[model samples]
Target chain A: MRNLWLFLSKYNAFFFFIIFFSISIVLFVRNNSFQRASVLNSSNQIVGKAYETTNYLKSYLNLAVVNDSLAAENARLRGEMKSAFYSDSIVKREIVDTIQHQQYSYIVGEVVNNSIHHKDNTITINRGRKHGIKKGMGVISPTGVVGLVLNVSDNYSTVQSLLHSDTRISACIKENNAFGSLTWGEENYDPMVALLKDIPNHVKVTKGQHIITSGYSTRFPKGIAIGRVRRTGVKGGESFLNIEVQLSTDFSTLQYVYVVNNLLAAEQEQVEAIQPAK
Target chain B: MIRIIINNLIRFVVLVFIQVFLLKNIGYYNLATPFLYILFVLLLPFETPNILLFVLSFLLGLTIDTFYDTLGINAAATCVLAFVRIIFINLTVQRQGLETEPEPKLGIMGFRWFFFYTLILTLFHHLTLFLLETFTFSDIKYTLIRVVLSSIFTIVLVLLSEFIFFRKKER
Candidate 1:
């Protein structure tokens, strides 16, 4: 018994290492699973507050660029206002359109923490559950699609950026309606580029063609710009064309984004659940 | 003894803040990222208990992870680094040397020894970090590039910080 005890004491450091190493590995594996919400994330109060304070300090550095983008977006929005169009009908009649119902709403959120270097990048925003931001909600900047909300606390949320390896957004080529999915962290590690997969070789894809959201899922509205096709190639024995896209939203300078609130999300999910399990 | 504890505690907070706030924003072309927090682990006193060393390293990693939103990756890498540190110190630093130098610092250990130590430890840490982060061999080439580039970046920053802060103490 003494010999056994002495032997165990001699190797206690190795055991401690094994125990701690395994705990870290466990945490890593659990974090990879989609549904599990972790408390040790950036949305925690202290970390979020620290990021918020730092973001406030850094926000001033990009004021000119942010102002320019805001001005451009304001101009585009103003051009679409009812006041910009003139009624051409000889007999003008007021018609109340009752056919269309709003399905998506936008909640403005300021990005406090953003990263593009890692294999799976995450962005932290100021809006959270207190502001109606929830998991799986789509987030987009003024220019293009951003990411999906992965976790939410009272005053902050973390977004799984489109740069993440596992993130896939349903997208289509604007020119030919070639349906495919946009993903990142593939062959090219460039933050500005992503891979558009499942596009059939038969589809006529051209360089500089616009890629937009297909609206197949409830996360985003249809026709939101995603990127421009940079190149297209076909690997041997593969039926799908390897399409490279240059993302529109420059994540390195992302300062603000809008979290999409799908009003009919619950209804759509309830209806989709009616399908029998295969 | 209390002074040592206080110094390390202050270092822990300062390093974590610098890592997540300052260095986090500085990455070159999504290739080179400088992780300066591991300096805390590398500079721990030579006489620190092995168990305490592992615990401190894990905590430092977890703290950085909370801010970075990468839960276990940094923790795992730092744990590996701590283990490597123990073995390296045992092999290179003699028992008699511990009496003269209380810890491994650039000023205390000389430039060449400290540089090699930082280079090897940083390489191991980055390799484990990026490998576990990508978690696949499919894009091994890109992962390798990130590891090599990030290691160099981290080494340069570590050496620079060492010279800037610890150079005066040597004089």
Candidate 2:
């Protein structure tokens, strides 16, 4: 009896650790994907509000830089507005097409917290659920795609920066219109990589070719600036383009960003749900 | 006692705020982002209940995971680290036993002992975390590199944080 008591006392802590760990693992594994998704949604909401408040305080400090970018964007927009006029039916059709392609809404935010050095980094902004910010909303600066909304609270939202390994954005070449997946190279902050598939050797590519989203995904709209090709090469048994892109945004000094909301996103997703899996 | 509890609570809030707000964002290199949140875990009362310690560590990790969207990776790592912390503290100081003083801090303990203590524990924390985060040892060489690089960053940031926030007042 004495020996048994000593043995139980010696092993008690280990037993406790094993028991607690097993229970937590069971809970984590049992939830399934949809339940995890919902938890992510709620956490995203709370984090968004917390980040948004922090962003609000930091935006005030970064007003000078933000004002400069806003001015530049405004000037570019005004120039396009002037050139929008045309009497010809072809020109009118082109104008309507441009308008349709340019469909986007921008909500301004500042990076209260930004990290580019880590393998995984999150950027928090000063906008949240109260401002219609939701999980999966794309974050952008005047320069390029920054990240997507992961969590949102009442007044702030956290963005999963493009630098993160988990972040995947659909991209296409401007000249050839070939689609590929863009992801951050874990080592760097700005320059990103794209995995392009099934492109023939005949297609001539050059340095600094513009790359944009393919609009195949609901996360981002077409023609929104992504980056420019930094390097082009062939890989795989068949010919494919391995492109390196220099992101327009300097993530190191990131400040104000726009949280984008697509009003038709939910409806579009619902309609597309019935399609057979490709 | 109430004042002491309030002081600890205030310290917890301040440390977390500074960690998430300022330090998390300031890493100039890929491996430089530090986990200053461990300061809360380190500063907790030595006599804190074992179950309470585990629960608090888990909650702290969950908060960070929520922000970074890394699932339960942080929570799992923190729980393990918290469980091991008591054992390390006991093994190292059991010869002399714990003081009647406040909490663990470098100033309270001598320099070299504290340094080694923090280093060994910090390495353990980072190793478990990165391993869980990666979930594989496919790139064994690269994984080792990350562990070393991230440990240096964690150490520097933690030391700097201790200096800045935990300066010992004249007794």
Candidate 3:
């Protein structure tokens, strides 16, 4: 017993290291999993508050750029307004029915902290549970798709940015509607680029073609702009095309974003979960 | 002793803030990110208990991870760094020679020794961090690029900070 105690005491540092390392690995694995919200993330109250404070101070430096983007968005929105369009058709019918139900809503949020460098980048937004933010909800910028909410606290949330290695958004080519999953951190490490995989080689892929969300998932609405195709190629013995895309949202300048709240998500999930008898 | 504790505490806070707020946003083409927080762990007093060193390293890593939104990756890497630190110090730094210099500061350890130490430790930390982050051998080449680039970035920043801040040993 004495020898055992002595042995343990002798190697106590190694034991301690093992313990700490195991704890860290456990935390890493647990938190990195999908849809699981852990307390150690940036969404924690104190950490979130600290980031919020610093972001508030730092936000002033990017005011001009933010204003420019906001102005551009406003102009785009203005052009889509009814007043901006000239009615050429004389025949007009006012048929208002309850056929179209609200499927999605947007909750505006300011990005408190964001990164594109790391293999799995994340963004922290100022809005959270109190502002209708939740895990698995889709987030979008004024320009295009941004990310999906991974965790949400009382007043803050962490978004799994599109640049994350695990992030896969169902996207389709606008020209031919050849749907595939969009992913980052694969072959290319560039923040401005991503890969569109699972696209069959038979599809006609051209440079500069637009890629938008397929709306196959409940997270995002259909037809949200994702990116533009930079190039496409089929690797030897591979059935899928190796297509590169230039992301529309400038993640470096990301400030304001909208957290999509799918009102019909619960219903969709419920319907999808219904098992058919074999 | 109290002075040492207070100084290290201040350093901990300052390093964490600088790393997360200032250096976090500065990366070259999503490749190199300078993790200045590891300096706190590397600069701990030589006489610090091995257990305490590991604990402090883990805490420092966890704090940085909280802000970076990488829950345990930094912590895991820093733990490995702390372990390596113990082994490296045991192998390189003689026990009896500790009277002249209390800690492994750039000013006390001189340029060559400190440079090698920082380079080796930073490389180990970055390699572990990037490997664990990607968790796949498929992108080994890209990950290596990131590891080397980030290690250089971190080593340069660490050396620069050590030179600027730490004073020469007062004989």
Candidate 4:
């Protein structure tokens, strides 16, 4: 008994280490497939709002630049509005109807931290659980889709920027309705790439053709302007067309984003989830 | 003991802040964010309890994984390093009977020995981490490149930090 007790005591630390290691492995394995919820999510609404305040403070530092851009946008919009009114009466009617049939309300916030450099670039916004921000909501700037909200806290939320390695936006060509996944390349931010697989070589793709979100996903509503095609060509031996798109939003300088609150998103998801099994 | 604990805690906060705030965003030239947090594991006092060391290492890795949204990669790498630490130390150092404690900072070992020691261990840590991250051998070339790039950056940063922190004292 004395010998056994001595042996046990001698190796107690090693045993404890093994036990703790096992516990950590088990915990990690169990949570491997964990999805984000409001509670565990980093972008919880309360934190989102707090970050929004911080973002507002940050914007104060760039007020002059923002004002200049806003003025430029105003001029561009006015010019487009005048030409668009005379170009087509049908387009004007559709625009009016779209305004009337707006699907969801928006909660405006400013992006406090934005990065275009990293492969998994994320944007931090000031808005959170207090503002009813939730995970998987779509975020957009005036130009186009910015990203999707991944995590939320009480006063801050983190967005998986469109330039991220994992971002998969549902994009369709405006001219020909050809659809593809718009993804960023590992290279520098010269021209963003899109993988338009299974596109027939015969399809006429032109430079500067507009690309917009397809209504297939709930994260983004249809008709949000994404980007324009800058270049396109057929892969040497593959059936896919390699295309590059210039993003509408300048990720280098981002602020004043709108979080889309899809009021019926939960209901829609529930229905879709059930219908798929049926 | 209190000083050690406080130092480890402070190191933890500083490493994580540098990681998430600065290094994580620096995706220069397709290289990864260098992990210098393992330096804490490498620098623990020689006489520290092994079980406590393991726990501390796991916690450090897990904290990083939480922010990165990666599951188990850093923890697995850190655990492997912690497990092999004693053996590596034994192989590298011939201790006298009178000196019972370990001095973790490379300054104690002289430049050449310290560089070799840090290089081997950092390489091991990076290899395990990047392999786990890629999780396949099909793209071994790319994975190898990443390992090399990350290892180089990690080594440079670790040495730089030592230089900065150890400035006031002698080796």
- B1-171 per-residue lDDT for model 2 (tens digits): 687578777876776677666776665365445787776777777767677777777777766765556656666667767767768777776544454545677777656776776787777777877776555677656667777877787777778767775656335
DockQ of the two-chain complex in candidate 4: 0.30
Ranking by DockQ: 1, 3, 2, 4
lDDT of each residue in A37-62, candidate 4, tens digit only = 23422344433444455556767877
Candidate 1 TM-score, true structure as reference = 0.96
Q: List lDDT for all candidates, in order.
A: 0.91, 0.70, 0.89, 0.72
In model 1, the runs with Cα more than 4 Å from the true position are A276-278, B167-171
lDDT of 1 at A37: 46
Q: Where is model 2 more than 4 Å wrong at Cα?
A: A1-8, A19-34, A37-49, A83-115, A120-139, A149-160, A185-202, A236-238, A252-278, B1-7, B99-103, B160-171
lDDT by residue for model 4 (B29-135), tens: 45555888888888887776777778888888877766555546788778777767756776777767215434667566567776877788888888888777655
Model 4 ranges off by over 4 Å: A1-41, A44-99, A112-121, A164-166, A184-194, A262-278, B97-102, B167-171
- The number of the candidate with the highest lDDT is 1
Q: Residues A1-278, candidate 1: write the lDDT tens digits.
A: 99999997787777777888899999989987875547999999888998999999999999999999999999999999998899787897788989998889999999999988777899999999999988999999999999999999999999999999879999998887878899997776788999999999788888999999998889999999999999999989899999999999999999989999999999988898897878
Candidate 4 chain A, run of 10 with poorest lDDT: A36-45
Top DockQ: which candidate number?
Answer: 1
Q: What is candidate 2's lDDT per residue for A1-278, written digit by digit as tens?
A: 99998997676555555655664455445432333533542235555566657767776776887788889999888878947655455543434444464346778876766666666667767677888888898888888889899767676667888888778888888988877788775434442443333446667778988888778877788888888878878766556666678777877768878887777788788998887878
Per-candidate DockQ vs. reference: 0.77, 0.37, 0.76, 0.30
TM-score of each: 0.96, 0.79, 0.94, 0.78
Interface RMSD of 1: 1.1
